[model samples]
Target: MIYSFKILQRYQLSKVILVVLLLIVLVVGAVPGYITGKWSWKNTPRITNFKDLRQIREEGLTISDLPTISHQKIRIADHNWLLQKVKQDNQSVILLLLTPNGPKDKPQVEWMDINGFNRWKTDSHQRVKFTVKIAGNGNGTTDSEKQSSNIEARFFRGWTNQQTYAVMQWYAWPGGGSPETGDWFWKDRSAMISKKRVPWVAVNILLPVEPLADIDPYLPQVKSIGEKIQASLMKEAFK
Candidate 1:
């Protein structure tokens, strides 16, 4: 009777091992599919529908008449990335930020409600701007002296119906001649375009804001911004 019991126990142990092996194989096979699905989804331009609208509301963008939201994801490296053309007032705003691992994996909010953004501010007269002096690494954790430098410089938010057009001129011509900045706009863009554009270095100088630790801590906020911008775009597109 004892011998019979030992045989039964050995058989059950083998069955358990076999089950474990199968689970491992299943997980391994599923991994590729999971990665592919994510890649495909990220590559696709955002599509808004009723379901997506509901999600936008949950993120804190008040949708009284529904807002239009459109986004295209740009993956810079295996890790870092950015999202473009996220707007809330159906206005075009280019949000540039770090997309590190963990919570920072999502795009950091750089600019919102952007009436227009320029590589270089033109003419002290036309530009409505603000500058903050930043010295240390922009991580807000630094002493008040360092953190106080977080600055948002802009010329104008709404001067006419052509906000993005003026901004795009800066983006495209970059260093193109401008009567305001005394043609410094073209000089700056020319220099930036000439150099083998350094990753993140160029933008860091333009914004000069510090990193906010890991992204996870700020993901909810990021999602909320994305959704609102998306909803605003959707409302316009649907109209």
Candidate 2:
């Protein structure tokens, strides 16, 4: 009887230890998520409307006046993005939003190949050629610099009819779980693995500044406004 009692005591002790270890493992695993998740929406910006965008920088163009929107259908391959051409006076901006449901069958998750403007994409159109870089498309830019907005507000400088146009684009995403800027590949790849629906917006703009030998002068305005818009929309999105 004593031998049987000893065996039972040992069995109970082992079972208790296993349960304690399991609890410790669960808490250990969940701690990081719990601590970091608290600030998920911390740095994200709020969502803004067209009016808010124009207000960011008016430049005496009277852009506040209701602008005209052209509902044009633009495609980036099997993915069909919602396209809008907003024109105010002599200034214009194109907005593209990638949605799961569009003219084409919905992709498991939507992705925008903003690489269409890269000069290598076409053989013709020699005179109006445009080159674009989005940081993580295997371009030499370091991951630290490509972390945000740089990929979104990609630079473009090209001439047509002896006039140069300076342009850029930015991708907008909500706060929580929003991929850091320029982390295009990692975010999408992770989404594909986890089967998470990726949501984002792209803003393309033709700056109102006069183009010169180089378009670097207009870059700051585009970047500042782009960041403002992102902050406005992202905070709202997460809210």
Candidate 3:
């Protein structure tokens, strides 16, 4: 019985050592990742097949390249962007596509920067703030699945260059997108942990509001165009 007790004790001790070793390995692996994610910015994966503006088309809409002079007035060397005009029915909008051009580029923050806003002369008053929902067709029937199928984009109204405009923006991922930068940060961290690369694009849609016009009347149109632009990005640009 004494011998058996000794054997049992040895077994338990070995098991404990094994568990401790595993925990040490996990910590060692995770510590570097945590530090890297917290302090360093990862370069966006290169997109080899970024589609041309003329090559992208929605069912009932028309797209054409716009002169970049107005949009490029305050260009940053590390930021890359494209401007295009999209027309649907009798309505039209300017689509601004911003993406990371270097390791340090943060397109989301760049556009949201107060200094950049001031340079553009964007008014401080926001007429409205809302979200635009983009739903994807998924086979899952669960609530979580349904929720994942839907992406909410950020929208607001601001006056830039003395023109009131309806603005919508989001960061486009492979399957969907989110307006919150935190979502992208978490996703990129996960990708880093898995040794994978995920590409993203920042999209902005601008629709001019006529003088004395109510923006509420144009929300639907803006949402529709935003959805179309996102869908096109997912299908063509980010695929």
Candidate 4:
């Protein structure tokens, strides 16, 4: 990055020395970045594994525990509270569900915030306690723009009064890729709007927020569900 001609003018260094010095600078600058990327990629948790959660039914869980899909046209006045990631669209689709919090596992919710704004006033309906939100990726890529990257999504646990819901969601790309933090390969894919990959489907998985166990530990199960949903959507979309 540093272009220098005058530095060589004063040193009178031989061409061989200049070449070696330049190589050293380039190698020194490049190694750290390469190592960092490798480390990040290796450490990123693969939170989704559908195979492990086959017992979800045996654990007193059923599809009926989940909410069905619903879509609504966005009213002009309700723009302020659009789910941060899915906001650019004229309509929003929500998949909501709820489960019992037995005495052993009470729900601990960290409500939701969107575009630096809390979503209390604009909350219109309460079908399920949790509201899945597809949040924006800080770079300002909205639901309005087209994207080419894989997926970027997360969960927001929250409650309305005593009822709580675990809101899981992510951006679904036609070409699949994981957007979680240690997946540094996607750092480039999501960085630019021109290369950004966006799909309309947001994979949502709602579960009870159990106090005895953190939802994070079950992320692999959570991820599995999202992946299945994402795969089905991708197949239908690309077809």
* Candidate with the greatest TM-score versus the true structure: 3
- Score candidate 4 by lDDT: 0.36
Q: What TM-score fits each model?
A: 0.21, 0.40, 0.58, 0.33
Candidate 1 lDDT, 91-148, residue by residue in tens:
4444432322331122223333121333333222232122222333445644553312
Poorly placed runs, candidate 4 (over 4 Å): 1-152, 177-198, 211-213
Model 3: per-residue Cα lDDT over 152-210, one tens digit each? 67666666556777777777766667777777766665565445445666767778888
TM-score of 2: 0.40
Question: How much lDDT does each candidate structure score?
Answer: 0.31, 0.43, 0.56, 0.36
Error of 3 at 116 (Å): 2.8
Of candidate 2, the 10-residue stretch with the lowest lDDT total is 122-131
Which residue pairs clash in candidate 3?
none
Give the per-residue lDDT digits (tens) of candidate 2, residues 16-129. 999997667556544554587843123222222334333222221122232536654566756555555556446665544443242122223332354443222211111111
Q: Which candidate number has the best lDDT?
A: 3
Q: What is the per-residue lDDT of model 4 for residues 171-232, given as tens digits with 9 covering 90 to 100? A: 34445433232343333224221322232322345444453334455455555455545544
Order the candidates by lDDT, highest first — what do you get? 3, 2, 4, 1
Cα RMSD for candidates in order: 22.9, 17.0, 12.2, 19.3
**Model 2 residue 24 CA deviation in Å:** 18
